[model samples]
Target: MTRIVRRLRAVAALPLLVGACSASAVFADEAATTTSTTSTSAADDVAPSTLERDVHLFVIQKDGSVEEHDDSTLRANTTSGVDDIAQRYVWFNKDIEHVDLLKAETIDRDGVAHPVGSEAIRDVQEPRSAGAPTFEDGVLRTVIFPGVEPGARVHLVFRKTRTKPLQAGAFAYLVEPTRGPVELQQLIFDLPDDLPLYADARGYTALPPVTANGRTRYTFEYRHGTYAPIEAGAVGYATWGDRLMVSTVPDFATFAAQYRSAAADPTANDPTVTSLAQSLTAGLTEPADKARVLYDWMRFNIRYVALFLGETAAVPHKVVDILRNRYGDCKDHVALYGALLAAVGIRSEAALLNLGPFYTLPAVPGYGASAINHVIVWIPELHLFADTTAGGIAFGTLPTGVMDRPVLLDGDGTLARTPAVQPRGRTTRLQIDVDASGTGTFAYRVEDSGAPAELERNVFRRATHRQAQQIAADRLRQTGLHGTAHVSTSDVAATRGPFATTLQGTLEHFTWPDGTTALPALTSFAGGLATQVQAWLAEPERTQPWVCIGGDFDETAEIALPDTLRVTDLPTDTAVRDGFFDYASHYVFDPATHVLQITRRLTAQFGHQVCTPDQFAQMRGTLQRIERDALSQVVVKAGRM
Candidate 1:
C-alpha cells in the first residue's frame, strides 16, 4: 500500500508545494490564469483614528504649489463615493498610522476633481517572520487607488514627522493582454527622496521607466517590436510597497528609542508588542540558540502551501490567525519569524523574493518592483538567511532561486541584497560480485555528502519515470561495455520531499558473439583482473566542494568462463596514494578450484581548485592508461586445466 497526500501536487505550472514535514501541499490550477492587475490604494478601508498626532506633510509636485488636507475638511459624507480626484478639495486619510496624513487625492485622465474619503481596509494585517506571526487583530485597509497607475500620470501629496524618506514596504504589478492588440507603454513608480529603490532585471522592460517631477515610473509599450518576454519567476520590488523596500536615517536609533518609550505607556498592555519593544536589544544570549528556536518553530508550525492567487494572495491573513490555524503562505511564515526575532532581541527584516528557475530580477534597474511576490526574511545580526517553507534541506541554506537578489523592505529604505547559501549535499554508490548461480553476491557501497548532491537532486527531483531510466542507462555505458537494453524504474510515492528515482536494467549480450573472446585482467581468462590503490586522504579543515552531486554506483558481475576454465596465476595485491587520490586492488586464485577473486577501491580528493575542460580531458586520458596496465588481456587455452 502507498500513502500519498492527494493535495500535494504542482499547480499553475509551478512547484507549488515545498513539502513540509506533514506533507501538505499547495495546489494551483493551470486553467485559472490572470492577465491584468490594477494598483489600488491603501486608504480605502481605514477610518481615521481619533488619537491626535503632531505630524504635518507637504507635497512638492512638478509645479510648486501647496495643498492642505487637514482634519477640519473631512471628505463629503455622500451615498455616491467621491474621494480621489485631481482638483476636488477632499479630506484624504492614507492607510498607514505611523505617519499622520494632511491631505490625499487622485487624478483622472481629463484632470477631473473629486473629494476623497477614508475607504481604507485596516484589518487585513499580515505578520512577518519564520515562526508564529504576531498579528494586530483588527485593522482596516484602503478603498481607493491613491497612488497613480500606469495610465494616468499620478502624483501623491503628503507629509510625515521625519524629513528623511519613509518607505511603504510595498510592491505593484501591471498585467494586460500582451498577446492581444494593446501595448504596455510603461510601468513606473514615483520615488520620494527619503526612499531608495532598485528593479528586477528580468521583470521590468530594460528601457527603464520615465522619471519626472521627483517620481519614477516604468514606461514601455507592449508591441511586438518592443516586446520583452516575462517568465514565471517575474516580480518587482520597491520602498513604497510590500516589496523588501528599505531606508535609513541618521537619528533612527534615537527615533526608535522614542517610539519604544511611547509604547511603554501605562495604557499599552499588549504583551507581544511590548515584549518586542523591550527585547529589541536584549533577547537571546547566543546566536545559534536564536536560530534554532526560529527554525524549529517554523518547521513545527505555519504549514506551507503556495496557493498565492490574485490580489488575495498579496493580502496577508493576520499572523496571529495563521499561528492559531498552524498554516500560512511564505509571507505569513516569514512575517511571524521577523516578529519573533524582534521579540527575542534579534535584528530581522522581511524580504520580497523570487524563488524559481525561469525568473530573475530584470536587468534594467527599477523593474524589481514587478519581479517578486514571495516573501522571506533575513537575520542581519546572525548573517544567515533560512528557508523553513520547504524540507529535505539543512538550516541556514537556501535554494538557487533566492540567491544573490535584493531584499525590499530592508530598514535602510534602499534595495538591500540578501546573500543565500547552498544546500548540504550527499551521494552514495556500491559495487559487488555475484556467484555463478546468481544466488550469492558480495558488494561495496560508497556515499558522499555536499554541494554536488544538491545540484543533482534539483534535476532528479523534477524528472519523471522515463527520465529516470535514461539516468540508469547512462551508468551502464561507463563500464566500457555495450548492448541493446531496456530500462525501468521503481514506483515512487509523492510524499517524499525530494524528486528521487531508482532504475535497473541489463545488457542484452548475455554470451560472446563469437566462439572465443579475449578477457582482460587474467592470463588464462583470469589474469590481470584486479587494480591497486590506497585509502583516500581527507581535509581536516576544509569541506567537500562540488557543484553537481550524487555520483554513486554499485557494480557486480559473475562468470563461469568458456565450458572448461581454470584459475592460474593471480596478480599480487598493491596499494598507492599521493596525499590526494587513493587506490587499492586485490586478487586471489585457488589452484584446486577453477575460481578467482578480485576487488578494487579508488577515491580521489578534490577541493577549491581550478578544473578546466582541458584538465578533464587529461584526466580521462590517465584513466584509460591505468586501465590498459590493469585489465589489459586474458589468454584462453583450448583445454581445461
Candidate 2:
C-alpha cells in the first residue's frame, strides 16, 4: 500500500507545543541527534530478519507538490521472516497521487535473481474503501515475490507523485525505524532553494545540507546493526527511537493559519444550518448544556464515514451536505457541530489532533494530513474539549485514546493539550445468602466512571440480549460458579452520571454446611479484581514503559451462612501501599450471625499515561500481594448439635 493510503486505511484499524517557539527553536530543544550504527553485531542479537537497504527520496516543488521514490531490500533469516516480507503491498490515491512500480524481484540463496512479471502484480481497491461513500482514491498494488525463502532477499522500488499538496502550498513528511533491526536507512529531501524546510531528526543522524542547481538537498541516515527487541505494552517506537520529521511549513501557527484559510467556515451564511442549530438548543441557556445537546445530536444523527477522496483529505464537506446526508467523518462532525455551536452564539474552534496511538507530537511542525488525522471542537468559553465523533462517550469525557495529546486549534493558530483526567475507577458490591439446601442467591452491582465507565456503558448498550446473557454466564463461570443470572443496568445514554450494572443470580452448591468450603471469586463481573490481578501477573516483568493510567477498583462482598453452619476461618487482613499503587483487603466475621464480610480496594493512580518500569515493578509486587490474599477462603462447618 502507498504510504498515504496505508496511513489513511490505518485510520480504520486502529501534538507538540507551539506558539512563540520558532521551528528552529523547537527542533533544537526537543530533537535528539544520534550517530549511525554501522556494525551489524548489535543487530544480530535480535535479528530474525534484516533490512539490508532502505532509501526514500522526496522532491518538493515550488508549487508544493511532491515526487517521491522508495527502494527497500529485505533479507529473511528464518521461515517466519520470509512470511513477514514475502509479499509487498503498495497503496496510493488514484485521484491525487500517481504511483509506478519501478522494480520487483527476489534473489535466491544461490544468488539467482527472479524478476516478478506483470502477472505477479495485482491492482485492486482497498478492502475498506470498497463501499459507496467510503470509496475514494484508495488503491492497493500487491506484488507477489518469486522464490522468497529463508536466506533469500526481496527488493522493491516504487515512485509516487502527488499532483497537489496535502494542504494548498505546504508539504510534511515523517519516517520512523521499523520494529526489526536495520543495517542502513536513508531519507533524502530535495527542495527548491527558496522553500525553507523545518526538520527534526530524532535518533537519526542528520548530514549537512547541500545546495546546487537552484535546489537544496537534506539527508538523514539511520542504522541499527543490533536487534532491538520489542516489548509489549511499550509506547510507540517514534517516542523512543529514530524518526525523521520535515515540513515546508515554517511553524505550527503557519500550518494552522493555512489550514484555517482552506477550511474556512463551510457553514457561513447557511440558513438551514442556523435553523437546525436553533431548533436543537432552543431551551438550553448555558453554553456547556447547549454544547452537550448539539454534540449528542451530532453523535446520534451523523454516521461516521471515512472519505479520503480528492482534497477531502485536508478539507471537510459543506455543513449542509453533512446535515442532509446525516453522515460525516470526524472532520465533517466537527464542521457541522462547530457551525451549530456558532449559530447558538457559542464559539468553538476546530482542534486538529493526532488521534493515533502516540501521545506526544513531534517537534517539527506538520500539516494535518500527515501528523494530525482527527479533529474535535474546542469550546474556549467553557474551556472544554469535545469530541463529537465518539458516539458512546459522554459529553465531558474524552476517550482515553486522545487524552493528554497536543492539539492545533484552527483560527487561533495555537497549540493546546487535552486534559488527562484521573480515572474514577470501578466499584462493585455483592451480597450472597445461603440456605439450608446449599443454594445461594446473590445480588451484584458495579459502578464506574472515566474510561472504565465509557467502556462498560458502551459494552452493554451495543450488546444484544443474548450476547449480554452469554457475557453474564461467562463472568459467572470465570468466578468458578454455575448459575442462572438476570441482569439490569442503568441507562448508559445518560451522560451526566456514573454508569452502573446489577446482576442477580442463584447458584447451586455454593457451600457445604458439614465440611469446609472454599470461597468463590465474587468480583468476576466487569472490572473484577481477580481478573485484574491475573492480567498484572501475566506480565510481571515489563521491559518497556507501561501504560498505567491512574484508577482504583473497590469491591465489597457479604456472605450470609445458614443457621446450621459456622465459620471457623477467615482470610487475614492486609494493606499494601507502594509507588503509584495502593491496595487493602479486610475480612470481618460476625460469629453471632454467621456472616462473613470482605472488602478489597486497589488504587493505582500514576502521574501520567506512561509509567516507568520501576513504577510498574512496584505495582506488580502489590498485585502479587493482592493475589495471595485473594487465595484465602472462608472455612465453614456445621454448627455444633
Candidate 3:
C-alpha cells in the first residue's frame, strides 16, 4: 500500500461568475492592501485563482456514542494560468495518517511559489500526549491528540493561512468528520476580524439563528470588498469521505523480507501474536504462505462491529489486543491482520484506504492520511491488497464494489493525478435471461466474468415469492399489465462461487393490451426501480464518489401466453451516449409466433447531479415509451361463428 498525496479533481456545475478573472489583481497593489475594506476588481472575483495553503486538524472523541467513521484529507495543486488553484485540504476524522516524504511544495496565486516560513507548538484541549508538531518544506502539519476523557468534549480546531487576499472564486477549504448519514447543518463562514462581513454561501441555507453545540465551530468566507461578488448557489461544503481500497500486495518479495526481519527480533515478539502464530504455524509452509494463511484467518474469524469515532479512529489500535479478542471494526481488522502477518515473517503495514460503502473519490474530494477512515493490510507479496472488514470474501476478489479509487498509503502515494474512482465489481452486470413457457424457467447467468455469485445471491435473496407478488406485480400493474405472480421455487446452484439461481414462477391471467403476451418491451429498468429512479430524479442526484454505480434489480419477467395474442408495439430500438446518459431500449416482435421480446439496459452513472429538465422529460417519456411498447393489445378481429 503506497501513501498518496492530497487531491481535488472534478465538479458537475460551475458555481463561479459567468467569465474568468485574474487573481493577482485582487491584491497586486500592496499599498492599497492596508485598508480593511475589500479589494477592487470585482471582475477578478469570479475567475479561478492560484493559491498556496496549509491546514492543521485536531480530533477529539467526546466519549459516549459513535457509529462508523468515513473521513480523511487531501493536498493538491491545480494550474489554469491565473486561474490556477493550488490548495491543500487535510481530511482526517479519527483513524488516518499514513506517512511518506513529509516535504511538500507549492506555487502561489501570482504564479509565485513559497514555503512555510514558521512552525510552532499549540496545545490542544485533549488529555492524550500529543506528537511533536512541526513545519517542513511548505507544510505546517501535525498529528496529535491529548486523549479525551469519557463524557468530555471533542474539539477540532483547524487553521489555514494563504498567500493572497481571499476574494471571489477564491476558496479556503477545511473538511469536517462524517459519522453516518449526513444532514444539512447550518454553516458559519469566517470573515476577516478587522474587515466587516464580505461574502455569503450559495445553494445552501444561510447561517443559523441558533447553535446546537457551541463547540461545533468552523467555516470559510471570501474577503468582501471590490473583488468579491455576492453570488447565489455558489456554495462550499465539507462533505464525507470514500471507503477503503485494498489490493493484492504487488511486491511480495520485499514484503517477505520485511516480515522475516520483524519476526527475528526478540523485542518484536508480542505474546498474544506469538501464541496465535504458534497455533497456526502448522499450516504455514513458507513465509509468504504463512502471511496468506494469517490473512485468511483474520478474514474468516473476525466480525465487523460498527463503532464510529472522530479522532481515536486516526490512531491505529494495537493488533495484539484485536486478534486475541477476535472482534473489531474496519480499523481494528486491518491492525490485527498487519500485526499477525508482521510477527510471522510476512511484512504487513498499516495503510489507510478510503472506505467504499460510504463515498467516492476524484469527483467528490480526495483524502490523504488526514481523511482515511478504514484500515487494511498491504501484502506486497503476490500484490495482494486485503480488507479484513469484508468477511468470507475469497483471496483475490474484494467484497462487493470497492476498487480503482486512488489508494493513499506509503508507496505510489506521491502521484499528482488522482486515480479514476470505479466500482470494481459493478462492472459485473446482472443479466437475467429467462425462458418462460408454461412454468417460467428463469436463468441467472452473468454476462461479464467480473459478475460474481454474490450478485445472484443478492437478487434471489430479495426476490421472494411474496415480495415479487407485491412490488414486482404492482409495478407491472402500473404498466397496465395485469397479473399475479407466485414464485414456485428459487434455488441458487452455488453461493460460494460464480453460479446461477433458477427462478421458476407461475403468473396467472398475465396480460398486456392484447390478452396474451409479455415482451422485453415491458422493462423494469425504470419501473422496476421506480423508487430509486424517483430518488435519482428527485434529490441527491449522485452518490458519494467511492460509491458504485449499479442498479439492484427486483425481478425480470417474460411470459408466453397460451399461443394466442400477437405482438403489437415495441420500444424504440435506439440508444444515445452522452456524459450524462447511457441508455438503450429495444423491442423485438415475431408476429408469426405471437412472442414479443424486450431488452432494456440503462446506464445512469452520469454526473453525480440529477438530469436537467430536458433530460428528465426525456427519461420520463422513455418509461412511457417502454410501457406503451410493452402495452397495446394485439388487434385481431375474429368472427363469432
Best by TM-score: 2
Model 3 Cα lDDT, one tens digit per residue, 1-641: 11112222211010011111111211123213322222333344222221122122211122211111112221122223211112222322222222222333333324333332223122122222122111011222343222222211112223222222111112222133221111222223232222112121221222322223433222322122222322122111122221111111122232223222322333235787767866786766676667656666776687666432112322334565565556766656766776677667677554444453322222221222222344455676656567666654444545542443334444333211122222222111122222223223232222212324444344545566576446444533554533343232234423244443222233333343333343333344223433344434342222211122343232233433334344444445655455434555455556455444545455555332212223444455544443343333333211111
lDDT for each residue of candidate 2 in 1-641, tens digit (9 for 90 to 100) = 13522111111100111111222322222222212222222543445678888788878787767787888888888887887678878766677778888989999999888999999999787765435354455677888888889899988898988786556666666565555667788877888878767766666677778899998887878776653444566555455445566777777687778767766764654999889889988887998888888888888788876543222356777888888878877777888988999999998888877775566666666632335667888999998888877877878778776786788898778889898665567889999999987799999998886766766777888899898887777777767787888778899667656888888899888987567677653543544776766655666576544455667788899888888887777778899887766888888878788778889888866667765556667677677887888666777777742
Report clash pairs, candidate 2: 1-89, 1-90, 1-91, 2-90, 2-91, 15-361, 42-226, 43-225, 43-226, 43-227
Candidate 1, which ten residues in sequence have the lowest lDDT sum? Answer: 1-10
TM-score-sorted candidate list, best first:
2, 3, 1
Query: Which candidate, 2 or 3, has the higher TM-score?
Result: 2
Q: Write the per-residue lDDT of candidate 1 for residues 1-641, one digit (tens) a residue.
A: 00001100101100010100110101111101211111222334322111111111122222212221222111212212222212222121123222333444444446654334566313233223224333332122232435333233222233322121112222222222212111122222344433333322212234444456665433322221211223222221111111111111122232223222322222223365335334543456776676655665575556785533211223445555555577767666665665566566677655555564312332211111233445666777777776667643435556555655554543443455555333332222222222232221222222223433333443445577577556545644544444322333222222212232332333343223333335444221111122221001111111111111111111122233433444443456656544333545555544354445555544544331212223333344334433443564434333456
Candidate number that wins on TM-score, 1 or 2: 2
User: Residue 368 of model 2: what lDDT?
Assistant: 29
Q: Which one wins on lDDT?
A: 2
Question: For model 1, what is the C-alpha lDDT against the true structure?
Answer: 0.34
Model 2 spans > 4 angstroms off: 4-46, 128-135, 226-228, 266-268, 306-312, 367-370, 434-439, 480-484, 508-516, 521-526, 533-538, 541-543, 562-566, 617-623, 630-632, 636-641
